[model samples]
Target chain A: MLDLLRLLSFGPDGWGDEIAQGALLTIELALATLPVGIAIGLMIALAKDSSSAILRGLGNLYTTIFRGLPELLTLFIVYYGGQMLLTELAEHFVEGAHVEVNQFVAGVVALGLVLGAFSSEVLLAAIRAVPKGQKEAAAALGLSGWRTFRLVTFPQLWRVALPGLSNNWMVLLKDTSLVSVIAISDLMRQTAIAVGVTKQPFFFYLVACLIYLVFSGASSVVFGKLEDRAARGFKRVGGH
Target chain B: MELLHAIGDGFLSVVGHLGLNTELMERYGPRFLDGVWVTLKLVGISVFLGALLALPLAVARVEGGKFLSRLAFGYSYFFRGTPLLAQTFLVYYGAGQFREQLTDIGLWWFFRDAFNCAVFTFTLNTAAYQSEILRGGIQSLPAGQVEAAFSLGLSRFLAYRKVVLPQAIAIGLRPLGNELILMIKSSAIASVITVYDLMGVTRLAFSRSYDMEVYLWAAVLYLLMVEVVRRVWDVLERRLNRHLLISR
Candidate 1:
């Protein structure tokens, strides 16, 4: 009993501090990747919806390649392959570019790339869900391309897209644990370390599970609030 | 030059290991084949065990004693909320601490290995999800039909089997199949615990070859597994729903 308390303490000797830091790293990792994912996803979505055949082909390839690959395999490709490619480019481009992919950058890029593939689906669906008449009306009003997208399309897209996007966020948050395998020392990695170092697997792991519950629960609550807000002023005209 | 050289050497080594650029093919066909066999066994057994355990557990949660319901709820929340990796560790390395008690109960031998532990965690994890799915399916059945079943002198068991189970299984088939595919992907997580399933074996092959060619071979194996299951499920779902398709 006392051992459990000691393990969770805040003192210098306690491992509680490390666990907290791990949680923070996981959060930071997700935050960093989330924006990258959203930007890449929107670009891919637009590319997929682009009138040009070349643009549509690029988007299809982007989603197909990443989506078809396993997340773990994708992680390995980014971590190992990214390093190999970056180092090679550095040697040629800048004598000694010293550009190495660290854990955070690797984790962000790996997770971000995969998330971009999935979120492209979400964004594309959102873009399509807008009543076609809205775009037609915008064009009829002489609003140009960017103006049509900016004024009429994008805002409606987010409101419609937020639910599915947030659902993807919850998944992305959970999957961040995969980054730990690549040596990112996030929550799961830290728990693995503490378990190995302490030799108290159940204690540390149960703590880890509790932490997940708190975080996942909090995320769902936030998602629920966002869904509610985004759903404002939109009532279903048909079946519930 | 090394980049070009690595690609050259990588391709040759990859192909030389097999005949006619059939790399995984001539590498002596059975290694991954056996790994896939074990993977399917792992998934099939765990899904079976999880479903069996979840049915009673779900019953306990929904209509059993109050304390039991809460206990089941706690178990569901904890297992479902956490990452699967943590659960795997708790079973593998964590079991070592309780060696004596497990041995005392003649269970240490079972807990001694990584495969057993991975299966155990997978079983428990899916059982929780299964229970929730079953519970939802049960609650969604029309109360009027149930009442009619009772009035016709059918016991609860008979009613569920004859009436509820059929409709539930119909509504549940697609979602359940999706879960099965997710489980197949999830079985890869067992690699972390050192079980050497398909992913672990692929990781080993990759480390030596350092060419992702071997890993690509592994992905094809996975895709085939997923596709086979998907096709079989399509047939089964169709057979079951022919009544709906035929229409009155």
Candidate 2:
């Protein structure tokens, strides 16, 4: 145990610093993913709810394809295929130019696409959960279409959406570990390296597991608070 | 004719410049199929075993005494809070550190193979999630149902077996399907420990040929599996809830 602590400590010989940095990288990756994913999710949700058949079809197809594929396979496709596509485009556009995608970017794009696919379903359900009468009333009051949605629909949609969105956030946090397979030095990968170096797979892996537990535990508390706040109005009125 | 020629050139360029190696695909295609089979086996066994394990666990969490409830909750919290990959590593590599003890207990045979270890880890992991889902389904039942069952002179076990389990199954159907799909996606991690599942084969093929199509093929296979599962679940849900639907 003493040796384990020394190994995980911050001195030159300790791997604690690397693991801590890896934890930070994991957070950065998830932070970059959250907005891009939510934006894509909103767009897909809107498209699915659109009047046009084509847009709905496109939205459905996007979610189906992304959600069906394994996250690791998606990561590989984005990392390797994205690299190839960029190289091909660069060659096509400029004689001597080349574009590159790093592991971090690949991880974010792949995982974000999956996140968007899953969350779009949640958002679509949330959007639909707003009572039809409410929208009709807004229209009856002569509010414009966008104004009706902005003033009447979006607020209610969020309360319905918060639980599912928080579930997605928890999943996305754990799924970030998949990027370690592509050699991004997230917490999982850092632990893998430590295991390889120290020949103590159990110890390092337990520590990594604990670190992940800390992250998920902390976020679950925050999400529970958010959910309570989201439900505040409904709770006061005896609504579920 | 012009379009045909351009297509041929594009194909040749993919073959030559991209180094797709048709010969290698022919060689490894069967191996990839074997990987798929192994993946399906892993998923099939784990989902079955996990469901069995989850029933008792869900019961413990929902109705067991405090100690049992906390034990179940702790199990789920520990498993759910961490990444499945870490759990996989802990089981796979961590088990090695205990080979002597396992051998003493005659369990080393189970841990000696990567496939068994992967299945064991996946079963434990999914049981946690499934237990939570089942617990939710059980809790969703109205308390009045239990009171009604008691008024009708049904014993607790009989009430649960006849009334609660069926309703809970119906309520949990969709989430359970979602869990199965998630497990299918997750079983790819088994490849990390050299189980050579579909993702493992894809990795191997990519390393050997440096071709991106291998990953695409694996993705397509996964998509097909997910689609079939979704369709089957839809049919099952309809059948289960047919009585609840109005004729209109």
Estimated TM-score for each candidate: 0.86, 0.89
lDDT of 1 by residue, B1-248 (tens): 88976775676577676653455444524466667877787789889999888887776776678899999888888887877777887788778989999999999999998889989999998888887777777778788878999999999888877887677667677667766776787788887777777887778766766665666677677777777787899899889988877994
Q: What are the clashing pairs of model 2?
A: none
Q: For residues B116-209, could you state the per-residue lDDT of candidate 2 as single tens digits?
A: 9999999999999999999999999999988899899999888888888789888899999999999999999999999988888889989988
C-alpha lDDT of residue A27 in model 2:
88
Pairs with steric clashes in candidate 1: none
Clashes of 2: 0
Off by over 4 Å in 1: A43-68, A88-99, A138-152, A236-240, B1-29, B58-69
Per-residue lDDT over A1-240 for candidate 2, one digit per residue giving the tens place of the 0 to 100 score:
898889998868989999999999998999899998999999999999999999999999999999999898888899889988899889988997767789999999999999999999999999889999998999899999999888788778988999899889989999999999889999999999988898889999999999989998899899899878877667555456
Question: On a 0 to 100 scale, what is the lDDT of residue B245 in model 1?
Answer: 71
Q: For candidate 1, lDDT tens digit of each residue in A1-240?
A: 997879878767778988998999988898999999988998999999999999999999888666555577678778877887788888897886766689789888888998998899999999899999999999999999999999788778878899888867876887788888988889888888887777888889888878877888998899889777776657767833
Q: DockQ of each candidate's interface versus the true one?
A: 0.51, 0.71
TM-score of model 2 (first chain only): 0.92
